[model samples]
Structures are given as structure tokens and as C-alpha cells.
Target: MRSRLPRLLTPLVRAALSKRVLPRVAFSGAMSAQILGNRARSITTYTEGSDLPRVRPHVWPAPSKDIMAARDFIRESAASPKNILIVPDREPDGMASGTIVSLVLQLLGKPESEIRIHFTAAGFTIFNPLERARLSRVCQKENVSHVIVLGQGARASWSLLEKSIETKALIINDQHSDRFLENTVAVSASRDPPSTTSSLLTYIVCSELHPEARETTGWLALLGIFGDLGARASLEPPYPQELKDFKKKYTSTHLRDLVTLLNASRRTPECGTRDAWEILQYTPQTNPAPTPKSIMKGEANAELRERLKDAKTRVNAEVRRCSKMPPRFSKDRKVAIIFMDSPYLVHPLVATRWSNYFDPNLTKLVLAANTGYAEGKVSFSCRAVSGRARKGDKGGPKEYETESWDINVISILREYLAKDSLLEEQARGEFTNGYKRATGGSVPLDVWMLFLEKGLEITPRKGDFPQKHALDYIQD
Candidate 1:
């Protein structure tokens, strides 16, 4: 009966794609029309038009005290002969933005030999312990004076970095820091929405740095936005209007393709930094202007594509498998819990990819877990649909936008996980409410299952979780 439901809901799914999916696209006009074209008529993609969104005017923001101080510090540090290490996370956004920052320093008359990059693998300290150790050694050997960390920062890397350089390093990140360091100058706008690390850097370079930087690095900053928030057409609260404003100024498809190439460049965790550096310097006369097609045509990119294709295939197969398994119905049949063990799977994509399956007609309290990192610890992603009816005139068990579900998700997880033992307990956002789901670290799969089973035996509760602003890292 459960398997047959897909056959029965086929028409409904089709209708939802037309009525629901089309309007929610991030942009409109020819590009949107192409992507959403004839969904109501035919499902074929529009292959002709430019996949890029139309370009709009870039809005430059006024530089704040922190950005100004950062520029002043870089300028002052470059005046002397001491080397500067630019530590970038080994990901597309970090690579692209870090490269741009490197270029900016050069334009300010900083010598290439004086500038070096220590790329963190997988963009975290925990994952790149070896890399962190190596960077510390290099900083000491090379007589490095100052360090600039770009993109989402690694909390674990900070202490090591502090000891490596004589002067405290500057961190430009959008993600929340694990804890405040005593001497380090850290810039973060986690409370603000839609501002990627790259975008913030762009604003600083264009508005405060040399005039030439505005012309050369504007596009790179735009690419950074796509690299971090590519799948999103529009973002929710705290995300600045500048993101939507910036999209109007460029071809989104081109940007999206560029992001894909950047992501592909760093696909291999071991040599991601080297790959990104080569890709960054791949350009001819002008600054790097790589097209997705051009990158894909390369032998390396071809191999990367093959790997990605294989991963996608496996992931799709798993989604199907999860879909077929019926949700565990409780004694009262009010809650649903799903546990998926996908080792070595892609990060974050699984959540967005499988979210559509949380149909309102199916279940209300949905909790799902997937294996995260190789350490046996689990990453939990959640979704909640309004199941019980309200005092409405009609429309039974309909889905409506509410913070209740996200709040509840955090509440439950906090209740289950022992605070003393749990690792990486903080949400990616304020209360993890932005994505209409709460996603964060939980205990290992066995521990989570035990908690889930226990929760099922008790009555469902709300607001059981307390909000926490600052938390530190935990071993997975």
C-alpha cells in the first residue's frame, strides 16, 4: 500500500512541481522561463538561452571600522619585509575569495614572495590537523609576520595559528566563531543573513581598498556568493538585499557554472588547495575568466565530473531506498523518525535533496540522521509539517511557514543529547530556524537511536530546548 502511494500521488506531485516549484525559483524573466518552461506542458529543459541571470549594478557598501582597520593593518604589514600568510579554507568560496584577497594585497604593492597561502583541507581545523601543523611549521620557518583567514573559519585552527605568528591573525568569516580569542581580530556577521564571507570581503575591497580593486575584484566577490549560496535563488532573513541586488547585475547561469568549476577544482580533499591555486592562475591576459564548459572540457575536470556523476547516482539510489521504507508510526502515530546511515556521503546536499519527500500528507514530526564525518558521530537534519488541524474553515493538515518546527527540533535534540558529551552542539544559524529545519551535530547513530526510541515512548513536548549563543567544538 505504501509503495502504491507513489503511483496514486503521481498526478499530485506533477501538479505541485508546476504550481509550487515554478514560482519559488530565485529569479524571473527569460532565465526563469527557461528553467521553468513548459513544466505544465513538457518537462524538457530549455537548452538554448544563456543560463546566466541578467546582470545588474553592483552595490558597494560603506566600510565599517573593522574593515577599515583590516585594510590599514594589511597596508602597514606590507610596508616591511616580513612575510604574510593568507590561510584559506580549501573550498571554492574560500579559494576564490582568498585568491582575490591575495591579489588585492599585491595590488597594494605587497610582493608575491612576501605573501603565502596555507589552505585548510575540507575548510575545518578538525579535518585538517596535519595541514594546520604544517602551516604552523611554515610560518615559523618563513618568518611570517601576519595572517589573514578567509571564508568559514576553523575554530580548532585558531589557537595553533595564534602561536605561529608573532602578531595575532585577522579572520574574515560569516560563520560564528567557537569562542572569542583574546588577541585575534575576528570579523563575523552570523547574526546577519545572506552575507557570504566573499560578499563581505568584496564590500571591503571595493569600498575601502584602492580604487582599482573595485574594477578587478567585483566579479570575483559575486562568484563567492554563488560558491556559498549557489542553489539558493533568494535567501531568508538577515540575508542582505544586496544578494538579490547583485544577482540582477550578472548572468546567474555563468556564475552557477563557475561555482561548479570551483567546487570541482577542490573536489579532491588531499590536493584541493593546489587544484584551486592552479585554477585561480589558469587565466591568460585578463584575470581568471573560466567558463564551466571550458573547465569540464579539461581532462582533470572530466575526471571530476565522472566522480560527481557516480556520487550522484549513489545518492539518488539511497533517496529512493529511504522513500520506500515507511515512516515508523508511534503508538499515537503522531511522530516520525528516520535513520539513514550513509558513510562518506556529500555534506549538506543530502538534506536539500531529500527534503521534498517530507510531504505534509505523510507525516508531521520528521527526524532523520545520516553518518557525518568518519568519526562515527551523526549529523541530524530535520523538517516539520503542521499535522494537527487548527481552527480553520478548511484546508486540513496544511503546511504553513512557522518557527515552531525549527524551535521544536532544537528543543528535542538538546533534551536528548548530553551537553557534557555532545560535540559541535551549536546551530549554523540563529536557533537553526532559517532553513525551516534545525540541522546540527548529535551523538553517534546508536546513541541517537536509543534517544529516539525513548522519545517515542513519551508524550511529545514543545520548547524543551533552550537557546545557546556561543558553543565550542567537540570531537565527532
Candidate 2:
């Protein structure tokens, strides 16, 4: 084989002659042969295709049953002749009622003359300043003969009663079942004093959500339902087929917008009632509608933010300063509660900020002022936040219970912890015994000074808290 090989093949022949080399050459040749043989087979196996159908277009489902029910309630309320009243659980409840009432009235073809609305407010003997102003404006614009008050308690002394005797009154007791309806009948049946003849009727409406009467006399029933329930989940039947589509399109968006507008108004006192009234009148088709921008840009919001900021700054500074001063812990272990007599005047934002500064760990007992009457007793908002309870427990990190006072003085002293341990102990015992006795408790002049000094130290921030003032985040 070597003698026959050409010059170029000589190396190959020599490699083959070596045992190790011959083995490698044979293995490489086998690999090359296999690769060449499989080339066609690999191509055939790799290539494949199949036909698939196109996806169908997506379709949106119909409006939910809950939405339809809400729409029907709205439409039915609009068609009624009786003046509708909208009341919510708090301040926004008033605004929601106003907006819903106005919209429904317009839908029902009633002029401003036919509908009258009022919201509750503070003051022992007179109308709340805001309520008074609203009443004055309403009286000036329309010959308002009927006023509907919503929510649980209806104070008899509010200044709205002083208006021209011609105006009739309707009180809707939202808390108790059948109470409003019964009261309405009683008021209508009772003879008005001989002096007031212009007021013709005062009516209270309640609801079983009668479908037969809904389209025709539905407004009255819806008014009662809305007034009593506020924005609670509905238990009524789903809406009819006719209204389902429209509700699907509008209900959620509208509610979100309404909530946003209300929160804006609430945070900004400068926004005032006029701005609120304008927002209520806004419609999607209107030129100057209440968009999120419009609501935030309104003057009232700006003013409120400025005031709130000032209040916060002042209060925070005072809290820091007082915290540095020696803790005036009384001789007894019982912590003295210090707070303002007018909690309403002391904004919640400021109160919360001050509370944090005073006790970052939330170990101290801080009583904030609150306004409301319960069980025929006036109470303050007493809040306690501590690591005492777990998240799911009944008495968790924060506790809110009403502390009633018999008289303003006792309330103020108790709120300030102005009384010494002995006196405070006595006051506590008296409060436990009866609300009437607690009302009579008195604070010494020195204790009153201490309370006043503590309050005076708290300063209002120059600008509102950024979180509350920003209207973009507020829902309608």
C-alpha cells in the first residue's frame, strides 16, 4: 500500500500504520458518513405547518343587576311630585342628597320651586352657621314651603324653624324603621298653630320599593329609601330590562365622580355652599361641568387647604413644644386627657398629627373632641391607639367610644383632664352612675388654665396637608 501511494497520500498511509492514529481516523470517518446520511432525514423532520382559525371579537357583558337596581331607584325618585331630600351618614351625605335630589327633580319635570333640601349642623339654640346661610339663600331664591330633614336625629331648635311660618316641615328618621312614616302622618294630621296657614303639608315617605307605583308615585318612596339608607348596599330587586344598558354605562362613573367632588368640598371650607350647589347642578352635557379639575381648582378648596395647613403647623409645633416640657403626670397613675372643648374647630388632621407627636408609640391616652348626641346624652369623640390589641381582636389598636357629658363645663373639664385625681375619680364615678350627674362636675380655675395653655400651644399649619388637598385622588 505504501509503495503504491502518491506523495500527498504518504502522510495518510503513515497515520493509518500507527495503531492509535488508525483508530481515530476510522472514528472520524464513521461520524462524517453518519452526518451525510442523515442530512435529508433531518430536513424532512424539521419542516411542518398547520392551519389555525382566527379568534372571534370580544363582546362586553351586560350591566350588572345591582347597577340596574340603582338606576331604577334614581329614575323613579325623579318622577315624583313631593320634594325629595338626600341625606348621607355625614357631611358628604348632604351633598350627595342635594345632587341626587336635584337631578331626580329635573328628570321628574319639577322646577326649583317644588323641591326643598336641608342638611344638619352644629349649634345648641340656633341654626348652624352654614345651615342658616343655606336656608337664607333658599328662601331668597324660591318660595320654599317645605323642608325635609334626614338622618337619625332631628333637632327641633335648628333656626330653619324660624323661617316664615308658611314653610312646612318634614322629618325623616333614618335610623328607626317605621318611625319616619309614623311621624310624617302625625305631623300632617296635627293642626298647625292658627298663626301659620301658608304651609299646606308636611309629608314623610317610606319604601317597600313598589314596582307598580314606582313609575308614577315612585319618587316619594325612593326619597324615603335613599334618605334612610344613605349609600348602603341595596336589597331591592334588580332593575328592569329597559334601564340595564344605560346603568351599565353610567352608574359607577357617576358615583365615583360624585364622591370625588364631595371629598374636595369637605376638605376645603373656602369652597363654600355656592360651589357645592354649582357642582350639584353639573351635567355631562353642560359647558362648565364639574370635572375633577374644576372641583379642585375651585376657590373653596384652595382656601380650605390654606386654613388646614396653618392649623396643622400650629398644632404640630405646639405638640412638640409641650412634649419637651416635663410630663405633668398627676400624682395618680390615671393619665389626664387633654383636648379642646370645640373639637369641630380643631380639625381632625391637626388632632391626629398632634396626637402622634405627643405620643409616637401611642402609649398615652388622648381624648379628641367629637360632636353628636346619643341616648339623649351629648358625647365627645374619645380615641385610644396602642399596641394593646391585635388586628382581629374586638378591642384592637384603636378604640372609639362615646363619652357623654351632662353640661358644656363638665364636658370641657373632662376633655381637658382639668380636675385633680380625686375630683376626676369623683367625675368618673358620677358619669358611671348617671349622665345627669356628670354634667354637673366642675373644674377648678387652675385646671382650666392648664387646659387652655395646652390648647393654645398647638398651632395650625400654614397650608393644608398635601394628601387631603390634592383633588385628583378624590373619587366623585
Candidate 3:
């Protein structure tokens, strides 16, 4: 069912494409009614030459003191002789946001040798003990002076890591609901609609660092938005003005294709992320930059092309196998949980698929967990559907315009996991830290098992389970 979603919604997307605009996709079945009934009014998405409701006029807010400080810090650090280490999660949004900072520094006269980038592996964050060890090595060897984190969580200070890795200044750019490091310079999009993503958020601040940044980095910002949000970026809107100008600059197909390619870069746990950074970079003089198609067909990128093909095969297979496992509900029916064990990174895809299957009012949350993604740890993804479409609504899914249930998912996870006796002896690092609705952790498998026993009802695997439900997808 997860693998079939794009096919189910493709026509609506094509209809949206025909008009050279983002799709005003309508969920036409019971999904049209329940998952998003008009519970709360919010920003809207529009279609040209059609009666699709227009997005609310967004009043741009002034940059905050944190953003100004971050802006000033980057300018000052970019000129220093000491090296700067950039830490970003491997997701498309993180990569895009990291890319934006890299470009800004280069423009600000920061040399290539002075900058270092490390893409945290699948199911990991910089705060992870293993990741900290690796980053600390880089810092010690390079004489690092500062650390700039984009779209990932962190502690307020670097005191936890080896003393040598702590830089003179620490800056973070994020929009997640997790408890960010206190007493730090940071830029946050929490005040914006939940939709404002990392790359878009980073561009908002980095544009302040240099004059040419706005002109040179629009494409990257768009890529970042599409990368993180995927088709949802098109299906939902009141897209922040941060992305308004860039949206019109590129064709939706081109942007979508670019997103597919960019996301493919780090889909697998063993896949190296630097290639993605290299692939996403804006070539100095190429007119309009290298395209996904050109790069795929280009002789120089055969390895990347093969990498994408392999990732697509692995992800689609995992999506079909795990999406049908069936979910167990928390007694209150507020959370629907499914368990999977896959080496490939496909939990989010499976979770998003299941999120569309349950009744919204009954099951407000969907969590898909992969117990085999990493050793001794499980990675999970969480998603929510807003509310049912209201009376006489026909243009789009009510979810695109309705706000999610008021209880934040991250808050719930933190509330429970932080105090659970199951994790008292363990580090419990980044347990409840993640973007607003997409919450999960690379936690000890036992921690997840404990959460299941306490928070959800568990059932044994069916002996005659439909594990081969996706055998045919191998040929797809």
C-alpha cells in the first residue's frame, strides 16, 4: 500500500502539473472526509486558472536576535584562519541546509581547506556517542574553531565531547520541537508554519551573510524544501515567502526530479553522503546548474546513477513489505504503531503510507519502527494527518489546510522516554529530539521494546504473514 501511494495520487499531481503549478491534490475517498475534517483553519495552497483556494497572505516576520547573531557569527568565523566543521543530518533537508552554509562561507572568503563537512549516517545524530567520537577526531586534527549545525539537534555546549573538539563558538539552525541547546545562538522556524523546512530556514538566515547568496542559492533552497517534504510540499502550502520567488523559477517536474535524485544520495546506511554534497553543489559557470537528468546520464556520474538505482530498489521493496504488517493501537487509540526490521532506511515511507490508512480522529498518530536499521538500535518515523474535510469542500484534502492535533508528538515522546526506568542506566541521547511531527530516535532496541510494552499493545507475528507481498516490486 505504501508503494502504491504515488500511483494512487499521481493523477491529481499530474492535474496540478498541467497548469504549471503545485498540485492542489484532493483526497477523494473517506480520506477526503475524516483524516482532515475542518477542525482548525490554517494557511491554504492554490492552483492557477482554477478555483483552488489561494494560500493565506503570509506576513513575513523580522529575523530574530538569534538569527542576527548567527548571521554575524558566520561572517566573523568565515574570515578566521582556523577551520570550521559543519555537521548535518543525512536527510535531504539537512544536506540542503548544510550546502547553503557551505556556499555562504565560500562566498565570504572562507577557503575550501578551511571548511569540513560530515554527514551523520542513517539513524544517527551528532549527539550520538559514536558520531561525537568521529567529529572530535576531525576537530583535533584540523584545529577547528567553530561548529555550525543545520537541521539537527545538539546540546547547548560542546562540553560533553573530548575537550579538543569544542569550538570557540557554537551555532545551530533548526525548526524542530525538541529541546535545543540552551544559551546558544540559533535560528528557529517554530514561529513559522510547521511547513517551513531546514534548507528554506537556513537560506532565510544565510542570505543575510552575503549579498549574492539570495541569487545563487534559490535553487538549493527549493531542492531542500522538496527534498524534505517531497510530494507533500506540492500537496500542502501557504508556502512561506522564503520560497515564493524560487518556486516560480523552476518547473515542478524538474524540482521533483531533483528531489528524487538528491534524496537518493544517502538513502542507505552504508551509502556515503559526501557524493550527495558534491552532486548538489552549484557548478561555477553551468547555465542554470547541473540537472538530475543530465547528471544521471552524464558519464562522470555513473556511480551516482547506480547508487540511485540500488536505493530505489531497496526502498520500494522495504515499503511494500513493512507497510502491510498491520498496526497495534495504544488503548486510547491515539497512537498506531507498526514494527519492521529492515536494513534500508524506509521507516518514514512506511509510516507516511500507514498514516493515510487509519481514521484520523481515532488514530491521530502513526509510528513505523525499523529494528534492524542499525545494530542494538531502532530507527522510527512519526507522522500525523490534520483533520477531516469540512462540508462541501472539493478542491483539496482538508489536511493541507488544517492544523495537526494540539498535542505535539515530540512532547509526548520526551515526556515518557525521559523518565522511563527502562532508560535510566542508558544515555538516552536524542530520544525525543526531531523535527516537529517527524519524531523518532536511534535508540537501544531494548528501549523501544520497553516503550512498546508500556505505551502500546503488542502482538505476535502471524505465521502466515504476507512477507512476500512485495516480491513483484523487485521487478518494478
> Which candidate tops TM-score?
3
Candidate 1, residues 428-475, lDDT tens digits: the string is: 222233232334434444444345445444322221111111011211
Q: Model 2: residues >4 Å from true position, as ranges?
A: 1-90, 113-141, 155-166, 173-261, 264-271, 283-346, 350-366, 369-381, 384-476
Instruction: Evaluate all candidate structures by whole-model CA lDDT and list the values in order.
Output: 0.49, 0.32, 0.62
CA lDDT for candidate 2: 0.32
Error of 1 at 74 (Å): 2.7
Tens-place lDDT digits, model 2, residues 1-476: 23442664455444433411221111121222222221111111112363433332111111133224433444554554544444322334444444444544454455655555544443221123455466546645555544454332323343444444334434322211222222221121111111100010111121122332223222222222232222232322221222233234334344443443444443332323444444444432345434333444453356544443444455445444333322223223122233322222233333333333333232343333222111112232222222233234664344323221112222443544433554444334222211111121123323323332443222222121112322232234
Listing every candidate in turn, what is its Cα RMSD in Å to the true structure after a full C-alpha superposition? 13.7, 27.8, 11.0
lDDT top scorer: 3
> RMSD in angstroms, candidate 2?
27.8
Q: Which ten residues in a row have the lowest lDDT in candidate 1?
A: 463-472
Higher TM-score: candidate 1 or 3?
3
In model 3, what lDDT does residue 290 have?
64
